[model samples]
Target: MSCKRLAIIGAGSSGLVTLKHALDRLPGWEIVCFEKGGDTVGCWGNPYPGFISTSTKFTTQFSCYRKWDCEADPASRAKREDFFRGAEYGHYLKDFSGAFGLEKNIRLHATVDRITKVEEGWKLWMGEGTEVFNHVIVCTGLAERPRKVKTHLPVLRSMDELPEGKGIVVVGGGESAADIAHRLAAPELGNRVYLSLKTGIRVSPRYHPIRGVPSDFLRNRLMLSIHRGLRNAIGQKFVEARIRHREKFERAFHANPEGHAKDEAINARRKQWDARLTAAAKDNLFNVFHTKSDEFLDDVAEGRISIIGPPKGDGFREFSEFDGEGIIEIEPDIVCPMIGYTSGLEDLTDGELRVRDFHLGCLHVRHADMFLVGFARPIIGNVPTISEMQAKLVISLIAGNLERPRDLKARHEQERERVEREFPLLNTEALLPVEMFPYCDQLASMLDILPTVRKVGLRRWWKIMRAPASTLHYLDDDYDADAVDSQRVHSPPLITGLLVLIKLIDLVYRRMRRRASSRGSVCPG
Candidate 1:
């Protein structure tokens, strides 16, 4: 087969996976990867202090690689320095690229300026000139732009303007806040730091549900039963909840219809959510605080941090000496904002790639010729699962083993109609919402259109079927004896019986409805 040319942007986790998948599927294809941050900072290339993946290493690793020697024990999670400091992950990526002869294809210190649609395909402008490619994949990681403290906290005015030796209050309750607090509390800094959390953040356990059947079993069962009718029902429920929430908000505000009451109402709602979130965070297994910002201010009154106004609906009110409270203030040296980030794809593309806003920044590419590999964000499923599905889909599309359904257009039209009928508000100009699990399942099913198993051992199958937990061990290509021994029996027959009973009830209900219709008279049982 003739080689095809492909260009990929950003050398982050997603970009590396895309390179690996493409090489496996299209061995003859000429691929080039571009990284703007030079060769020093992609994946494990650069190690920033206090850097660790939020995701476990098992879920984070590529499908082809297994981190654990045996499935009996969970794979150990790697700290930031372990994976990043010595360029361990970078070495892995380099080795992966070399294995597939991809090292020659990577171009470091290259930046993609814009992409323009051309007659045959697309043209990517990089550095001083342009490169034409049959296909282009954007693997820019999830964070589009960092959410800075200055942007979120208007009261700070400027980070540099803050005074020295005074405690700086940082608001936010996420992992970032924890890191910042740790930094401030360091002996070298010798500065008092206050963390203002409206509600506490929940820190996930190293592991979840030590001894219960995996949630995936239940979720899969529910998903399998979601036929067209169930989909309409689910969609309608979502619409109703949205409408009800809006109505409740309007009622609570009780402002003039012509007046601008939205801001106040939104603030009030935000405060309520903040309170609930804070409570949840406190009650979490970890040491999350449930105290209000005002309580923290009380501590400030005792020479902790300056007392800002009592935590009001719209965060702590901005206080000045002009106000009644005579609070002594000290300037804080550094203000670390733990605000989140958005996917930074706006400047990466010149609007040539269609992004579906609802899918958490997924590109809208219907053709098998163009595949989006790893765009799902904040999803529970492992990254490799989605990547593998994408790889298979693209492979099938390229090999001509799978063809777009003849009724694809009609199906899409029907889906639109269904959405409109069930979710009128969602029918607005915004894109259709696609959750991670459903998207993964859909992609997997599509790729499975042509069933072909590479190879599998009986021991591996038994281990996978009996595994009571969701782990990457199941997805690994290598099979180990310990993995098989650690497996547990499937859920008892009682649960299966209950499911069968529910199906039978539904069957009987449908039959009764048919009989009632056959008899013109209202069938009085």
Candidate 2:
């Protein structure tokens, strides 16, 4: 096949992974990666001090490269300095690019202004009106724009603008709120920080696996089996309930009971609902909460941090005084608004992209050549997995590997039918991180693209098994050889055997339970 010209924008984790995958799939293709930042990771522009990677190193790394040797423990979170300072991530990216012979293909210090569609493919416009590329992949990342906190509060302009060494309050209950609270409460800051969450959050119990399998592997397998049974009995509603239950279970551990109290009898009904949810979570292995934001609010109220009511009026005003109503009157030096980020695809693509109102930001694949990657946020999985899946799908489409009808109307109808049959809740939104891993795995399987595992010899595997996590090296030749072989072949025999054993155990457990129930002695629910 003739070499195709591909241009990748933003040299972050996603872009680097895409570059590596593209090189592997289309070795003859002319690939040019344009990164706005001088460094590869692009963390230089928006550097966050004391930032840590939320994802485990195993899941975070590209399929070919494993970070297991360097802090391989999935339970331990990687601090900014541990991986290499934020700046050093860029260097690792550079090294990754070089290792794959992609350094020469990358155009650093170059920003893509706009991408316009052409007759053949697309044209990317960079600085000084330089037009380039036949194909373009925008890997600019989710954190490109900051999400605005919609509150009428005059004192709180932005979270980042909050003063240090004074009482401060943060709104929102997601990871962003947790991160902001952690940052504000840091020992160095010496400031009282309060997080105003509408509802309490579910924190996962951190655990490290003794073997190759993650702790979630066994738990998720059981959950997935139960989910399948529920789906057969109650359909989509049951699946949704299970998903919600799983989330609540995770939240229960961090829940504060005091927050559930209400002043009025009608409010007590709301509290009942909260109690029901908490009880439901109790049945599961995970922990959850029935707490309100006011619990955290009270801590700030009592000299910890100032938590208060909603600001007067709706939306924003020109300016206002720092009156001590609900908010602390102290003048904040910096307000670190830890609001989340969204995909800013409105400016990039036209209405033709067709984003369903149900699933916002996800593009309907109109043309085989154009594809959207990292659109949906998965709650159960990792982001890299999603990106990898998207990349594989795109590659398949470009290679004409996907089964498609020639007739336009027939194809459209066929596509709709497929979506309805396969993904009935095609419009359903996904929670971040968790959904990420499964969605990526699903996408890759759909495209028949296996993960590119680096092959290692027996000696190398032995060495890696014996070596400590801190001393492990990913780029070692011994590891690479075996990983490469693993990528080419199907699932390893050992993995298949383990899977069979797990299934046998599950079957035996189910039969035993069935036999106990059939005895009519009233088996414990």
Pairs that clash in candidate 1: 144-342, 144-343, 144-344, 163-331, 199-278, 200-278, 300-305
Best by TM-score: 2
Give all TM-scores, in the order shown.
0.58, 0.60
Weakest 10 consecutive residues of candidate 2 by summed lDDT: 285-294
**lDDT tens digits, residue span 213-252, model 2:** 2222222222333322322333234323533453353254
Give the alpha-carbon lDDT of every model: 0.45, 0.45
